[model samples]
Target: MSRISVLVVDDSATMRSLIAATLRRDTDIEVVGFANDPLEARDAIKRLNPDVVTLDVEMPNMDGLTFLEKIMRLRPTPVVMVSTLTQAGAEVTLAALEIGAVDCVGKPGAGVTAAEAFGDLAMKVKAAARARVRPLGSAPVVEKREGYSGGDKIVAIGSSTGGVEALLTVISAFPENCPPTVITQHMPATFTKSFAQRLDRASAAHVTEAVEGAPLETGRVYLAPGGHTHLEITSGAHPRCRLVPADPVNGHRPSVDVMFNSAAKHGPRVVAALLTGMGRDGAQGLLALKEKGARTIGQDEASCVVYGMPRAAFELGAVEKQLPLGRIGPAILDLCSAAAPGRDQ
Candidate 1:
């Protein structure tokens, strides 16, 4: 395989050098060029045509968000945003992701060691290089669905990699009164909390980060917390969310497998969907759901950024249906409504 060529774009010379050197630490990644600003980056992009771009969220002449929007609108290449470890920077970085940035890394602070920060940046860059990003004009569009109901139905959704944009589409398609939904998206604690907030702002349905002992209610989507805690379901007269401390399963503490397996065992009628992500984290758990007679769905390859988890599930005979990102929401709603008759929320 050819090396992943990268272009580092930042106004600060130190940042540019630091990012370039960090990427160079991997023999598989090559620092093709460095750009001090968007103008310089534009020229480098035209000249070098690198595989990935490491973009600083704050830049001179034009901001990173604006440049990112332009890239999504025109070029459609994967972009990894470099942002400060601040509240405002977090907000801006999330905005960039919505505008088509593949992923983000917090810039090392005065107190943070560069080695540690760049270690993460290198991984994100490699992931970005493998991601399939759609241009802004041609991206999937999911409209808000109506007539969705909660009929003793529970939904479990899992994703990573391309999940931010994918979940935005899937959750926005839900009605104001939808089934009780649980989600596991691989992310950091800071990013997961911010993501829940962002999704709450964008979606008609209530979306919040899952808290231990929270009741599973209609019209709300609970996101598993990003930490050493795993989210599970406790079946009874009233299903509720449970947060448990456990070793990372499949290398994720809040692993998709943990959530799926829990829901399948406890949920009365489970509607499970695995979205785009890398690796085999959710495959066996999704299969477990299928064995328990739960309705299973997977995002199809053409719409996936990585297609690893979904593909693994599909090949394992776990997916009852494989749909595009835009269609998965409606299909999930359909399954929930059909699972139990004579109930609507």
Candidate 2:
């Protein structure tokens, strides 16, 4: 296969160099050019037509977000955002993802080594190179859905890579009093809090980062925190969130498999959906849920940015229905509605 060519764009010379050098360590990636600002980056893009671009969240002349919006509107090229690990940076990075960036990596912080920060940069670059990027216009106004009764069922969702945008769409369509929902979106440790805040603003359901012993209640959505804890559910009359400090499962803390498997033990009154991501972390766990008679849904390939996790689940016979991104949210709600006829339990 041809090497994945990349253009490094950052305002700081040190960041550009560090990013280029780190990507060079991977034989599969080639740093085609560097740019100190969006102007130079635009020139480089026209000149090199690199397979992918690594963009900084902040830049001079024009801000990265404005430039990114322009690129998605015109060129529609896959981009991976490089950002700092902070609340401010997280908000900007999430905006970039919604603007069509494929993934993100954080710059080294105080006491954090460059090696640790850039460890996953090359992998993300490769994923971006293969990502299906399309022009993203203004987000469609999702008219809030109604008539959703908080039945006995609960909802579980897992996503990564393109999940920020996907989750925004899904959650926005939810009614004010939706089912008790649990989500595991693979992200850096510091980013989940900001993302939860973003979700809460967009969603009628109360969204929060999972804390220990939070009961699964109607009108609430618990997002698994991103750090060293895995979010699990304790099965019983009152299911509650449990944060486990165990080692990473499937190379991810707060693994989707851990969450899905835990939900499976809660019996058949579960509704689960796996969205776009770049690994098989949730496939087996979705299969376990299917075996226990839980309703399962997967985002179809045409609607996925990477189509990795959802594809794995579909192939494993875990997905009872595969639908486009616009439809999965309503489908999950329909399955969990009190008016829906009885299924195996």
Candidate 3:
């Protein structure tokens, strides 16, 4: 019931003022302190102990990424990155997310108003305040397994808030010949391409931003391109990606619900999982897939950053099984195996 206290960290006075003013607009959020750089930010963090921190991706003296790493290693506080909406900025923001930031929002660029840039900053800060921040450490090492024959089954995953690190953990464990997979991670239009590239670099399976008419082939992972369109799967002997330009579902253009509903048409041939997120976007869609006999999984709460999407789906009886973050990747692969049980079996 208490207000969410926030520390604003940025080298730019303009940005600090803008961020502080924007957050103060929300009745539930209070800007507790400001820091011109990471050194000042460090002292502010120790003194104010704000529930959340809004961090700029690039700052003077100490870069945000290094400071974020130090914070996660030493203190493990919830953070939301404020970044520029450029390709390079996207890469850095993704890095910050992987380093344990709960979420991110872009800075106002040329022709973009401050309001447009930070419209959702307060909401994200609220979510960050509730996030489960993990200390920096070695990721769980998933032992590679053999005997995978994915067949015609397609895999769909949905995530939000802390998805960058979660998705990296999940997808990096995938084998070279993993099943066709599609992901709808909540992100900005400028970020998905870089994220896909990041995923491709980390995982054995090839990952890319989804394009209309692309075949959903084995060993390929399609990430829904954020911003203008929703990624859907078309059913046929050979399934393919479909990008639909429609109104945002669940307040998101690349809504997980749209993707899951589309994949649901494949029935038992589809396998879906909802990972750590901050809303109910994918709950009903996962339930629809379950009703159509698809195998469904949810990331258990202990491993979730926000525990929103998976919790919603689990409550709706959409998840046939729930597993930890480290286990979800292999579990999905197991479900997609050719020898796995189907609707008739």
Pairs clashing within candidate 3? none
Q: Every model's Cα RMSD, please? A: 2.6, 1.8, 1.8
lDDT of 3 at 199: 98
| lDDT, candidate 3, 218-246, per-residue tens | 89999999998999999887889999999
Q: Which candidate order results from sorting by TM-score in descending order? A: 3, 2, 1
Worst 10 residues of 3 by lDDT: 336-345
lDDT of 2 by residue, 78-197 (tens): 999999999999999998998899999999889889999999899888888878897878453344445777688899999998899889989987877898999999999889999999
Sorted by lDDT (best first), the order is 3, 2, 1
Off by over 4 Å in 1: 110-112, 143-146, 338-345
Please, what are the lDDT tens digits per residue for candidate 1 over residues 1-345? 999999999999998888888888899999999999999999899899999999999899999999998988878889999888776887888888888888887788877777866766777788888889988867696744566655778999999878888898898888888889999998766678889998888777899999999999999999998878999988776889999999989978799999998887753488889999877889999999989888888999999987889999999999888999998888788778854452321
Give lDDT: candidate 1, residue 320.
83
**lDDT against true structure, model 3:** 0.91
Q: What is the C-alpha lDDT of each candidate?
A: 0.86, 0.90, 0.91
Better of 1 and 2 by TM-score: 2
